[model samples]
Target: MARRSLPSLRPTWRRRLTLALRGIGVLFVLGLIGLIVAVYIQKAQLPSFDELKSSPNGQMIRVHAADGTVIVSIGPSYGEWLPYDRIPAVMRDAMVAVEDRRFRSHIGVDPIGMMRAVKLAVANHGNEKRFQGASTITQQVARTIFLSNKYDLGRKSREALIALAMERKFSKDQILELYLNKVYFGGGAYGIDAASRKFFGHGADHLTLSEAAVIAGLVKAPSHYSPTADADAAVGRAGVVIQLMVETGKITPAQAASADLKRVALAPEPKQNSVRYFTDWALPQLDTLIDESSRPLEVWTTLDLNMQRAADAAIRANAPAGAQGALVSIDRDGAVRAMVGGTDYVTSNYNRATKAARQPGSSFKLFVYLAALEAGRKPEDTEVDEPITINGWTPHNDSRHNSGTMTLRTAFAYSVNTVAAKLGQQVGFGTVADMARRFGITTPINTYPSMVLGTSDVHLIDMTRAFASVGNKGVAVTPYGITKVTANGDTIYEMQVDRSHVLVAPYVAAQMTDLLQTAVNTGTGKAAQIGRPVAGKTGTTSSNKDGWFLGFSSGLTTGVWMGRDDAKPIPGLHGGTAPARAFAAFMKPATANRPIEPFETQVTLPEFQLEPDQEFGQPDNGGFVDENGNPIDQSAQPPTDQGDEGAQVDGDGNPLPPAGDGRVAKPEKLDQDWMDRVLGRDTPRNQPAPGRSPQRDRPAAAPPPERPADRFQDSRPTQ
Candidate 1:
């Protein structure tokens, strides 16, 4: 029967099909050879393992100014290195469960996983972009190390080959470590180490399952899943990761549900730089300051709401284009009252007040003066103001008129550089540096003669605290912002004032204060005078690269700085100009209702005889005067000199008729009640959760009384 069939075996259709099959097989073999050769060539060009480990990423660390107010967040984290053993097991489980369910059974590349990915891609109408990736953890490691994010066959073939090599060369744990360390987690972070610290103020090893899930979810698209950039999207992505984890039995359904309810809800955060700067500074301390298992925090700060408003307004109104401004204020008790870390939070979140270390110019002269006073030199003592060289670095005075021999008082008033240099030399550079350190200059000091002219860099908060010693009658203060911190409404930590020892002798501080008072009262810092007893020094760097005004009243010490973020010089900018003026503006509004008080001096001031002189040195010659020297109308009640009254006072201080529709300016108390509400003093029983902005009410904010000269003149300086 077989011999009979063999005669018909060579039918036309069968012969043709056989030839076609042979030709197709030959083409397929040739194509496979070409692909292998192409892959080898591409793999040779791919980066080695060392190079891919250094790629950049987004990492965010936030700062806050007030309680429950996020001020700023630092970004672009340079990833912190962490070892495999240091990583939490749960964190590893979360990542593996969501990223590679077959991670344990795979040999570099997973055929089963690839088929699954292909199936999903087909379901999505062949859109590979939406396809679930089949890349094993080992494959990901290879791609991350050796390939760009391109969707091409050559890259894919090489990636698989490299992954197979990696699997042969390293253990499973090693591959996992490599992947975890190199993966990008958004907010300027790379690696699990940086991601954990950037978002939770801790290391990867300590991450909870929920936080780990979020980090694992971020591997797909960092920008879309960035908590600060888009909280809802980030949380939604985390939910998907959790779903995968649960489906794989890596985590219990209850665990996934709990993480979704708690972890995802914690993603959203505020972005303003002013409050963020403080929060960023305080966040890390929470781990040390409170129990690790505490719930979400409600950190209270020593930020006076009124003063915070003043600082914010001053920076925005006075900083020039291309120049950012920062202001920090503290009370004698070392409580930070207010701070402005940046001018426009939206433009740049870099906190000049907290992070920048710029030359303070003449503002740092207080330390030099303090050193001089402590060395037994009086304010009236004389020093030569001639030009001098320090290690061949010549230093010059701001003006020719400032040259020549002058009193220490005069030198300080004009912010004369030569005299400060002379003092630094005489008193010793080490002495000056030590004194500055004692007075709260936390930034490392460059103990050179130029340091006398404020050539050294220091943070604004520390610099403000230095002057606060003058305000506190020589008592050194440790500037602090966090007053209390609660976790999920439970008390966790509280701040205790550490102002104790006198950093400077009372007489020395008094003499220094007298010298600085001359600066604000009549010299370089004259624009900073707030119609009250206040003293400060003006500092303008060489070529006006930086301008600073550090001053203090009896109740508050404040420092202001203005300069370009790039440290470029600003045209026509001076410490005595806008910076000083801004200080005055902030104080005028901030100190409205508080009774004027006198700073502690070596000797009791004459006008401050009774009740410890709450007159701000406004002589007891019986009346108060405005900044323009206009006599203050101090009648407790409304004035009765109404000329058919409808209007009270004109654009000027002169009384206008009642029919006069011209708006009048009158000083009023700051609405502290509204401030209390903001600081979480008395929350309404029916308000939103903590950190959400509540409906506000302001009943006390009032306009400044107009001066008679302001009526017809455009005297206001451009901000």
Candidate 2:
């Protein structure tokens, strides 16, 4: 039957062909309608030319100094816009050759390039560059500025439509400029200029062929090809770009050879992100001030770049070997001028200045003394300096000597542990803790007797702020870094400059300043004196684990801390030694240009005497004698070193020469001449004679029966 009816197989074939043709026509019309609808939707969603030209696709926060110097840039960053003429010819050519070979010949979406990319992807087993497919430079620009990378058909269609529209609206040169200026080059950089500066430490106009190739190669997979992320991969990708440039006739083989990949060096970061310690502290503050956005922001900070450099250098120079150091500087207006979290920021990012809660040692005595003064205890009030046991805890002076009777001024200046502990008891420990809070110390302060001796751990920034309040004439100083934030050159948020209420009465602050001044002038903080009146305190923790010097001179206040991160004792470390020296080193340059302002009020300093006059025929028994006229045991007692253990002072507050051959014991291997070398100071303090060993045994304190640790063992050097 089938053989007989080969019947009109021709008609059946024709009917099938007609059905197929009709289906194809209907599909063609439907496709045409869908394409038109997509075009209209994408066009409606398209941004204006002005918006596309100026708006960034991501958020960027640029932190600036008071002088507008960029301290650091956070998130995606952009550099100055470069005109087409200013863009290096090699940069433009390299980008064209590697990213879109048919860039100039095509409208925007190059079919030939797409086909080539398809062939490559198939040959490579679908391992095309991440974030890069067959998109042309113009299409990439459209995607970057206009469309999301949703990996959907609609996104790609929109990208093509925008690219075509861009081609018609802008000249080829203008399109290329937009592409170069708006594309991401990774490492938080956007735009050719930003990427050029980020990679080569210069502008796009100064890009060499190698540098240009390196930047151009990053367009495929910015994060993967970023030189900062992987230098070798970036160089390899750059080599591919150079080869493409040669193959595309953008450069000859000889020119490719001249584009030395080995010469492509990435720019070093801003002092190895040393300022990150500052920016990390300041960036989170912005979230509270403004709504999140993709727009670029400029954060004007109170940071002084010069002061920051000086503080960093000082910490580096003065921090002892095997120890970490931190410094924070603030101005009278509570502006944070400089902050150094550690000696090297790259090694350890733990912000010791603001984050580390360390025992302030004798620095905590500021609050104790302030509380005492507020309790109506005059600085000249007298107290006996004998061994005192409070709650079964015997507190000894750092010197381990009972120097008869002394005024409160002399006691606080010398950081006498016995006297401070006694004062803490006389004025309630709770009141002392309350005083600390009033002075801006936010850490939980313990009301124990040892709290007066700084057993409570506190942040350096808080300690510095407390001292700043005193320097600010009792006006509470809330330490701040950001002054204002601006988006696209328009103000978004600005700090309302309001100094907090008075923390203490003006006269009380003046009295406290007088005591601090005496400490720096003739006591433990002597090393911090920078040829001017300095109101400061010296703090050395148990076994010299932590040494701190917080001082204010003129209108600037700075705090310096030095110790092991693990809280191990530093050999022969004292607050008056390295910490004070660093304070002086930093403050000298930090305040060099500022006007010198004398403290508004000065208390009449009483005559401080620790020993009887030689004319009285009092034997030089080292200022210690019992009521029975017998010489006290001096064996194994810690000698008064530079800090806290008061140096012999005349009635006029002048430091007397060392006793017994005048050879002071110095820390081993420390540069005694660092002040002369780094600060150009001619005056050299006590220098140990040649061949004298710096090592001196510090007798560990006999811990109290039930105490956790002997807080009475003076951390400061004793006479």
Candidate 3:
């Protein structure tokens, strides 16, 4: 009777729920099986353990100096394969303690370890929105040797399957050996043996327990934990690793405490010829010159080790304390033979020679003079060097004394700013900017009158390379660091440098070199004179912040700049002082053996009418104005003290040019440094800063009637 009366429950909600759960379980099982099959298929496409083991060695990048001597061996070099038994047991224990505690007991992929990693990842996710890794030694070996390091599920699954296959094929000890031998330990070290040598100055077999633990801790982040990078961080990480070993019973607590992290000493910083500056400059060229450096590569660079040594010595000797210096030397063909970016690359990695664009000051006179020459003016053309005002930015000569009504040659040789300004104005500032660009200057240039006196900042390498064209006799020399490139044990790319392209005609080069030669001989660049035929310019900024000596020897062109990185004035420093002396010091040895080349120029210059506001004739001294007799604005002037620092003109009979007197429009844009140092600008504020200097004062720019220094001293023009 009870069986007959039982209620039907076949279609109840509970039964329906049970059926749905069963369907989900089956789907989950099927999906897991499908994932496992897909992983196996992907694993088949990855490199096999044997194929990877026997792959070609991609070990060294040998950078050769100019004389074909290998100066730097840049990659990890492994001589012999380290067997598992040959490796110290302490190292193996330390690695196992930190990297994988259950490495011996678990299969290739440990689910427990993975779940623990996920938990930690969730708890400690600061800003990084992802899981940390729980890769066992076997999984690491799989990823390092047989698979690409990608984080997608497909790659991760393949990595797992490959690890499983690797575990099945090799013994536990064998897998451990492969991992220890192949894992990257940073500092270009690829294996345990190289890492041992790199950090401990010894082999892996001789590692102490402390060193082993310290090295083992590097598996997480080699660079961050490397003793070379930071000893305290390495010690802290090593301490954690030792604690893990103690908890795992690999070592006693007393043993862990006794382990001296200080025992891990850093290798000595190499004093050898690193050429880091040159290599750093050349690194960017690879993206355009070579497609990729996947295999072994060999590069022959343009570095001349001997010249580099000389340059370093020179920079050290001349650069003022607390001030920095940069030097760049280029051959006649535009090859950068030596580049000293700073006093020491170990102290500062900033490459001032290529990276900095400090104002050239009077050094920029060469372009303006050249532009004047291009505009039908000859070196023999007369220019009045006196107090002048143009567009409100008045520039003075390097010295208060100027050779009144001097020839254009003497004007450039002395770095006469007024004459340069007049010439720039006459030929148009755009013409001078174009001329500079023609010499390969890519930095943005302003068209203000101050640009004539090198208010425009320029790089040392660019200025040096530009001068190399004059040294090379008309052809524009393109600076290059790499001469040859080899990949996969074969010469894949050989540079056939096209030195035939002409940037300036031979006649123009000869004329420009001749003019520069006079500068070195009897001009402001007299400090750079090395006896033989040499041509260059000396430049000092308004505040004496940046000093420059850019010149060319018979065989080489070199540029030197001395200044503080903060743009503060170095007391009594000028282009004719430190930079010129350094140039002389470097060039004396660099050009000692080379033959002298004389500049031979044809004397032919066309005659052309001057610009609208122009003048072919000028008074000895006058208010600066254009050929149209228009009153030029000289509203912005330098500080009285700064104006007295560089070379400037002082004439006994300075005449004022007749100009149409009218209010001139203030320039919308000018050199910011000039604006900051000279005319104080009140922007987003009513008045200038408390310590700001006053606006341009024409009366203050005049020299004192009496000489402050002794007349008995050698009276060369200030630079």
Which predicted model would earn the best lDDT?
2
TM-score of 2: 0.80
Model 3, total clashes: 20
Model 1 residue runs over 4 Å out of place are 1-273, 387-394, 401-405, 600-719
- Score candidate 1 by lDDT: 0.65
Tens-digit lDDT track of model 1 for 1-719: 55554444578899999999999999999988875666566556555545444443322333345555554434545456666787787778778887787888887789987777667666776455644557888888777666766765567666788876676656788778788987778766768887777676777877777788778888878888877677778778778888888888888889877785244334334355465555555567666776644233456677666678778888888887778899988777887777788876667777788889987766777888788889899876787756566665455432222345657775666555567778888899889989888887888887755666666778888888888877788887877777786644466677877667878778887788877776664355646767667788777654456778888875788899888878776765667666877888888877777687765431111110112111111101101222122333434323223111001322222343333334333232213232233223463444433443333232233312222211111222111
Tens-digit per-residue lDDT, 498-548, candidate 3? 877887666667777767876665455656767566788877764467788
Q: Name model 3 segments beyond 4 Å from true.
A: 1-51, 54-86, 101-134, 147-156, 171-173, 186-188, 221-225, 228-259, 268-274, 293-298, 375-406, 418-422, 490-492, 598-719
Clashes of 1: 24
User: If the candidates were sorted by their TM-score against the true structure, best first, what order would they fall in?
Assistant: 2, 3, 1
lDDT ranking, best first: 2, 3, 1
Give the residue spans of candidate 2 off by over 4 A.
1-13, 33-51, 85-89, 104-132, 206-209, 228-231, 252-259, 264-270, 607-719
The candidate scoring highest on TM-score is: 2
Residue-level lDDT tens digits of model 2 in 341-378: 99888889989999998888788889998988888988
